[model samples]
Target: MTTAGEAVTASESVTEGESYDFVVVGAGACGLVAALAAREAGKSALVLEKLDEPGGNTTLSTGSVPGAGTRFQREAGIDDSPARMVEDLLRTSGPHEAEELVSWMAESSAEVIEWLVDEHAVGLYLITDYKHVGHSVPRLHAPADRNGANLTADLVRACDRAGVTIRTRTPVAGLLVEADRVAGVTVDPVDGVRHDIRAEAVLLASNGFAASRALLERWIPVMAHTPYHGGAGSTGESIVWAEQLGAALANETAYQAYAAVATEAGDILSWTTVELGAVIVGPDGHRLGDESVGYSAFAEVIASVASESFTIMDQRIYDYVSRNEPRFVKIIDLGCVPEAPDVTALAALIGCDGQTLAGTLAAAAASAAAGTADEFGRTDLAGNGLQAPYYVCRTHPALFHTQGGVAVDQHARVVSTSGTPITGLYAGGGVAAGISGRDGAAGYASGNGLSTAVGLGYAAGRHVGR
Candidate 1:
């Protein structure tokens, strides 16, 4: 009685011959959000993850995302707006190829967060403790643990509820091109067989090439020696595939770097240590440049100066930051951070002269208390100064993720080299040009990476559905 087309529609699976509305490559936060947006709008979507797990670098992050002018911010009595958010981002990142995206993301940030929480049942509460690395206000929203894995899990659950099929360990070998248009992709399964998935729209939300040494050397050569702390699923395959389709790449050299990853422990020391008046010391056990440049930019300074380093902090600052961040509290319990009662003991602990350590801490505390510039020109010292009972941790810089990929419009459509939209092709997250200024780690702002990932994915999913 029913035709073959009706049977395929009834199946709700993306079969080889039948076409879906949206086919999202990658099942990380970006791809999951994109699929959710599309499916929520009554569009058929299929999410393919090359890895067995869905979470990528997103899982590795703290999962903090910013929203401007949200109801939560208003309730918290904080004043903000799209314009203010744009100004903050530009002031940190400088001008770049995707300057317009800064405004676009800022404008839609609140809506994106709201949608994720209200519509998808994702648990995201506004963080009022302190403004992180590159923000001027307390606009960050995160889960209870401040882990992105929670966010990714919520999105996956949302996608499942929306009847979207998410297949893991299914790698997209290449795009199925019909002439100049990208129709779908050829996915390779474990059986060594290729399956064609035809879709009306394709989204490249796979990730950046931080895992690929060749691509890192090609674009971000300066960061070649840095530790790679990105998602294993990222090999620049998605970006390269898109570029081959005439997609224009922009801001390819920009990346998010962290200066405080424990060198031996293989854990992030949390930037809170530095933000709370801690200082980075080189091999000589002397303070380095400004710690206020943020973990992203200061990472470049660390890489250029020394491989072995130490973060010195006081008990009061450590307790305050650890109280707010559960991850740091765990780090404290791990005994990774050694404590010293005073400058002399601290010098003995780090193998340095007591006079030199005493002088450095004294000068820094004096500067913070007097509200004057130290030798490093750092301001905004939390808790005013470091007190007795200090803590020290050996740390190093790491490359988190590349901030460049396929260029897209505000709507997240992959644009060709001529600045025209590539038919049926969309991109977001690390697979798209980021809002950070072109090149180097200096331009990275707080939550800039996740803002682009979730913001652009939200846009692409909604726009593509229409």
Candidate 2:
């Protein structure tokens, strides 16, 4: 351990004057990928993570990721290309996305997936074709276990095999800058020891501000009171550090708000509510938007409401899907359960008007029968009508992560507002602004986090050794 004076110098330089080729902050998806890529390019890389474990929010998430024109897609007879993927993203996320950035992500998505499979040994599973998320194509891929823990473990193993050094329980307090370039990082070890990791290139993959209440309110006002589901270490340290060095910020207002979250005590639960067949309703006891819409649209619907809503469904929906779909079984195991067997009783318990709920159900049934339901563009509901012993559980808007951060060019190089490069620093994953523009398909599932993390990390690492 070092005192404050020693800590300062530890951040500034090392006693041996030895320097690595790259230093990655936050051993999450982006950081791990960056470290692996740097090592692949014959550079010594070190990963600093504040948590005791290696995976950040990525481990907590569902392992599924969207990629276009992948080998898996081709073998499965799914016709997709980078151009189609780019067009779909531009259409779904809005035209405001940086064309250069989106283009890079789209073109490199397949390559990233291939890298994960070839190098990291991430087993691929092709499920439904973009049924859950708003992808226009069926590009989502997952490991044997749907939880992101599989992906994280795979990456950890790969990093270890590749001889990348991972320093867990080490928090990066600040960056060391020489002129406009980032030369190293100051880190506080778990035991309170301070150390300086000097490097030729520094990648800020320290995640978003979702876990920091102060930073959330300052950057994304929509998420001020919303609960965060990511790791405790996602405190926007990189965001603050980068901004202090005059780094440009982009899409500061964008964040990913899951439509339904379990109102459990500590952290927000994201997978259970939506993955199950629960239908969200307003306080008036009427169905809100299509529950099947992607996370963005789901968030928009919930955000449009002034009061918290409820999720209503029947045991039949649960039993049917749970028996038919393995993913549904996983959802049930994750804390998603049906409400009690009485619709009226459940409504009363949730403070909703039972009569109004019945009327809404009847209306929904009629619309489904007539094949005229226009809500959220959900036409599939016409097949499965609501049946008895119904259930309802209140829900609130919860944020998974912010979609915006330091602005970067196509090569993952941080750029200023005046179109000048902020030398030496780079960002990826949630630390980089989303390629999706404001006002795009609010619920489009386009692998905004995973694709950008791996794609930009690859670009940054390739640039580092060159």
Candidate 3:
């Protein structure tokens, strides 16, 4: 039997006397999906979440979901297939990924998206061939808001409609095991009550250890100071319990670091730079990498840089976006400098060397005059140049999410170091050791985290005889 160090309360006792076919811990994307899948299979499922709201960090995310061979792609006439997707992921992430798990993700990604659209009524549209963190293909899908909040809102609505009981502010402290199988979970209700709820299977859909400093120090040594933007509830308590029950962990070192994050706030802001034709420069005011590359690639370079970099652009870039793409204009205007007429003062605020900034602008102008070189791959810069006034903003590498956790098999069963299954327990989402390795932004693929969460959660739900 699983138990928490805390005591049981009156409200927890109500759940303690109950039982379910499937008990899903965490109400984040993966947990919600797993609960829905179990309910679809006619199983009674209960979702235990430590937070009051349903969505976890996912709701706070830019809602880009990546999938290959999706119906949406077919409708859009985008050429894609599971095999090609797998090859691309392996190329980006390398051998650090579990072949079996990666294969499962690539093969079933389309179905997962389809489920969201058809079953959950989630509205999705094909945006630009948007590449995520490290994806080589244009496979990112987003709702109208381009934030995962839409997805989470729809999932929560669907779950509520389907009568999937969600226990908010209730944390799963441990798993209940019967013989070699997980039979239920022990919960610490928000009301300060503790109780045991039996289930045929338990899905640890909780998030990764990004929010838990203690867990990171123990499992991922390199991530001690990585700032987290996701929910604080993703503390890896489930992983800790699984390990206590003899489960093995894998790929505990992988994480996703965004290239340009706001210094005052941890919000991801570098995508605006790329979209607005800005080049990132190091402390010495030199261009760092090809700005034309995707955000993931640039972020990796920034993370490896000795000093945090800054994005340099011109008012013309801002004006072009404001006139053409109003949506992008907001990002640029809010983040860019020289909102006034003075460019040199903006440079001072952004901490760029005045002379060095002037030199860079002149060089860019010469390149533009020659019409031969493109700094970030766009020929538009050939004529435009930064001109007299320029804009710059300080940026730093931001650790937004962890990509690794307890390693699991294809069925989402936590795997032992000896390549054996730790029966009765399962993991998904960032908590499940990520398929991506330590290769940086080049290792990113669109929808890597969300797809893995849904795919593995689905697999785990089905395995529980739901």
Candidate 4:
């Protein structure tokens, strides 16, 4: 392990005898935010990250977080509120074990964004480009470039400015408890030397078990075979440790999956391509299913048809998506998106019958023209119609992350199976039970992950500081 000179927050490596008022596990968006909040509340805070770098899965995401009522939304002339966000989330996620968390986070989301921006100087703007998965209004906020890495960097900088020490390459072996209350965490570094660091309160923001095949098979068997595309540190050790302490688990089977990851390049193709009138087709050049089912739920559609599929879009849709998603520009630069001039050329690309491909496009065009729902019950065709000179990328479905863990109270404190809050033990982000639904991918709304991550982190730190 390196010294403070090599760390992101310019903090020294945690020594055995070091103690803080707040100790946070995982240096992702949640942990950093919690540490910053703790500092703001006049508390000593230290963050421990397993990875050498701070950001975890947050770096790979779009960095979008939902805020129901914020100044940015008000300035954009968008009407929204926490209640509206709760309704939208419930409509998409249906019934869930963490339904209370949905409302709690929704109420705290706007404050989280404002705190990150107004207080910490994290650059965030309201996104008005397109409607997100569950929200009715444009309440989702993101970085200017819409990159999660930028968000992570901003938070890291905020932590540094707040004098929050972050120790990298510090993996927590287990929780240190006294009298059934969490006291601190035992650090297990690569050199195998163990250090017991004490803290008045411990926050588990270490994310979920998306990278753990055994955990996936045990908790979410249906998605056991799905490809994982999250951080390596998400191996469910936090859940295991918490469960050993009799912490209650909720929404254990819920997760988020994406439908269109570029197969060879392993880059996310952005569902905006489909949302803007692109279609995914099977090997036979036949439409797979409704493309507008939203990305997470659409993964099941793609998986049911084939191991891999082709996302078909035209120049208009491609250019529109490229204007917003910078990652798509890189995908195009890598020659991942192949161009086909017409139906025959596209057929040659897919090795399918030209007539079959032509028939499929004709049907979609007919549906768009008539303003009627297609056979798949998709009616919201956004781009009007597809033009010649098509771009098709081979895509596959993958699991982005699991959205389940130990249950937490409204204050973000870990609770017992008997419904009592575990003293000194708080959880947020993927380490806490997600606000998404209890079972499947269909319940995940856009920004649901960050909503819980940042929201609960803010709440946990404030409560601990108090």
Return whichever of 1 and 4 wins on TM-score. 4
Which tens-of-lDDT digit does each residue in 1-466 have in candidate 3? 4332234333445455778988999988898888888888888989998888888877867666677888888888788887888888777778784666788888888888888788789766665543444555567777765667787888889888888998899887766666667777878777876778888778888887778888778765555665556677878777777776666666666666566665544455536445555667777766776655555555666665634777666676656545533444445556544453454664576567767866666666666677856564444343656654666556776556677767788788887667788766788997787777643445656567787777888788777653
How much is 179 displaced in model 2, in angstroms? Answer: 3.9
Candidate 3 ranges beyond 4 A from true positions: 2-15, 270-272, 290-300, 303-308, 313-345, 361-392, 438-442
Q: Identify the candidate with maximal lDDT.
A: 4
lDDT tens digits, residue span 1-466, model 1: 1111112221233346756999999988789889999998899999999888898888888888889998999999999998998998888888888888889999999999999999899988998877887788889898878888898888888999999899898888777767578788777766545567888899998889999999999999998878887789888888988887789999999999999887657878888778767898875778878989999999888788887788998887788777777878777788878899888888887788888878888888888888888888898765467888889888888899999988999889999999899888999999999888898998998888889889988998999878
**Tens digits of per-residue lDDT for model 4 on 76-146?**
88889999999999999889898999999988888889989999999888989788777789988998878
lDDT score of residue 143 within candidate 3: 76
Model 3 accuracy (lDDT, Cα): 0.70
Please say which candidate is ahead in TM-score: 1 or 3.
Answer: 1
lDDT of each: 0.85, 0.72, 0.70, 0.87
* Clashing pairs counted in every model: 0, 4, 13, 0
Q: Sort by TM-score, best first.
A: 4, 1, 2, 3
Clashing pairs in 4: none
Quick one: ranking by lDDT, best first? 4, 1, 2, 3
lDDT for 399 (candidate 1): 92
Residue 36 error for model 4, in Å? 0.7
lDDT for predicted candidate 1 compared with the true structure: 0.85
CA displacement after TM-score superposition, residue 136 of candidate 2 (Å): 1.0
1-466, model 2: which lDDT tens digit per residue? 1212123654344432547899898888888888888898899999989989988888877666767899888998889898988887777666653557788888888888888797778675765533445566788777665667878898899899988999888888777766557778787787765657678888988888888888877877666776566677778878877777777787766667676654533333333334444567788887777766665667666775734776666675556555544554554555544456666876776677889877777766666667775455555553445667775545666677777788888778888777787777889887887776643227245467777777788778777767
Off by over 4 Å in 1: 1-15
